[model samples]
Target: MSIISMGTHLQLLIHPSRSPIPHRGSLLQVADHGVRGHRHVRAHIMAARKAIEGVSDELNAVASQNMDFAPARRRVRTAFLPVQQQLNHVLFKMAVPEIQMEERYEKSSRGVEIFWKSWRPGQGEPMKAALFFCHGYGDTCTFFFEGIAKIIAAAGYGVFAMDYPCFGLSEGLHGYIHSFDEMVDHVIEQYARIRGMEEVRGLPHFLLGQSMGGAVALKVNLKQPREWDGVVLVAPMCKIAEDVTPPALVLKALAIISNILPEAKLFPQKDLAELAFRIPQKRKMTAFNAISYSDQMRLRTAVELIKATHDIESQLEKVSSPLLILHGAADKVTDPQVSRFLYDKACSKDKTLKLYEESYHSILEGEPDDRILEVINDIILWLDSHSTLK
Candidate 1:
């Protein structure tokens, strides 16, 4: 019976006079054995302590070499671009007419740098209309929307998209949404800049939003009631579907934690790639989306998304733009029934709602090739009808 107390020296405490102590060995022998055991334990402990201290010193030296986070972020973006280009090439076929692309960086009112890109058909073709896109949560324009933009551009319309702050190659910590209002303001500011371009000045402008982007588009239209000629929402997150949101007790816990650890990625949510795409192969391709923020949901971002949806639902009547709401009937990400709710309650007289049976959230990108083309054709026809001189 020996107890080893670990400290500067290993102290072995032995009770030599316990009841029923007639054991296999004498008390002096036991004491001798305990002394040897403590010595062995002390030697191993000293060795481990030295090893840990050496590793700690090495880690500190490595960390000191790069204290600035910005350059590390840039390195990550550089690696991501090659993957983005490869995926873009596989997705956007050159068989479609020649489309000229322009990429640029601009600063938001809040001083966050945003990455933006646009596509337009070449060959001296005049732009019929401008389609500005807002990507969904954890999605970047460079990867998923590359093909969608090409399709819209080949259809004789100029396509534009902005990677929001903290998303894609944009500046700020990734997957952190400080405030939903700030996000809405940033989108409006970027699109307003695009709308002011000399080439697109008088052309009709349409806002295309997917999932979380839908909430942004709605808020933008609400902010400036008559600026947009039309708006397209794909599974707009008006309200979080009951099935996907956390339980009441859990949400209450999150609400409290958000105030203390706003940026902490403590919220647990499903990996959206599995839930958003229906096809198994297409779902697997999402693994290579290098610039996406696929980490655990951040506390502030998740709470803001919930708050934004609630706010959007309350003011659905104020959404005055000509609306085209497309939803997947089986979408578990955002409720299709909510799209029906928006169509029923929205004040827009030209609102149209199309529910694709058995489709998932990524209707334009993740659907079958035929379905993707069909969705694109529908969008083009809508834009063509609305863009005509009226």
Candidate 2:
């Protein structure tokens, strides 16, 4: 379970020594949130999308409520939810914060308000520690931070995450979505800047991405090939689930549409208010927090992200950074099989892959918190095992 630490920092929940803990009868395991996390994600998050603003609330509600609806021959969960993501080892819900990114980074960089918080280790210890995160599409750093930040912070890692360029309260053009190259390039430059920071300088620096964030981590690691200890991709969208429309088609559409209607959104609005009211888990979907807040801030854009992802297949071999790919087999979004493909193909010697069954694309957001923490713990354990930072 010891993770190598050379470049940035790495954190993962590794397999335990000897026999593993059993999950039967655990409230967290079978919690209402675990099973319904995606439905809620689609409904609650799809609810606040400004992209779907003009779309009728009725359609919005239908889309939100019916996101999981499948043809009669196949159940919604059975038909659309990719099998690779659905049957994985374990995927938990990640929820940390109801906040948004803002300021300086936005004005100078992308126009989105980006705020950062740092948590230091206990006194008496050196302060050369830092972990920076980049978020995925339609998401704010606060969204994932809501669930994972505390455990990571508590583990003595000073974590940093910024709202995506066009996300959250970051001041930027509404529909902006960065290319994988652009996004990761920004990450590498910032990483160097962070490494220069006195408190974070000497310590192991870890760069991480979950979901689309994982793709960012992968592409950045691919292009820059930082000698840092490790890079991690949780449900990295290296290739994508085979289900999406072909890249040629998507790109042609983007080319035709970007010029005329760049602001045109991808996801329309929906009824989270109704869906949240339906979740049996503690009932009422987080009382309308991040999902609701996010629903409001997101645009229907990510085509750029998708396009950037398609280009990476040619570039993955350039990545030299040590990597750990964590994927949920049951992810409804990114395919876990894609993760396997990367672990096998990436040109890194110190690479690792961990797969979780029953986890969703939003592995960090399921009802049971263990799935999320465990994955993070594995990352930390791996980093700790390989680091000389003490």
Indicate which candidate wins on lDDT: 1
List, residue by residue over 245-295, the lDDT tens digit for candidate 1. Answer: 455565576667666656655433334544567776666556445345544
lDDT of 2: 0.48
- Cα lDDT of model 1 overall? 0.68
Ten-residue region with minimum lDDT total, candidate 1: 41-50
Candidate of highest TM-score: 1
Clashing pairs in 1: none
Q: In model 2, what is the error at residue 237, expressed in angstroms?
A: 1.3
TM-score of candidate 1 against the unseen true structure:
0.78
Q: Model 2, stretches more than 4 Å misplaced?
A: 1-113, 178-180, 247-250, 266-300
- The global C-alpha lDDT for each of the candidates, from Candidate 1 onward, is 0.68, 0.48
Name the lDDT value of residue 219 in candidate 1.
86
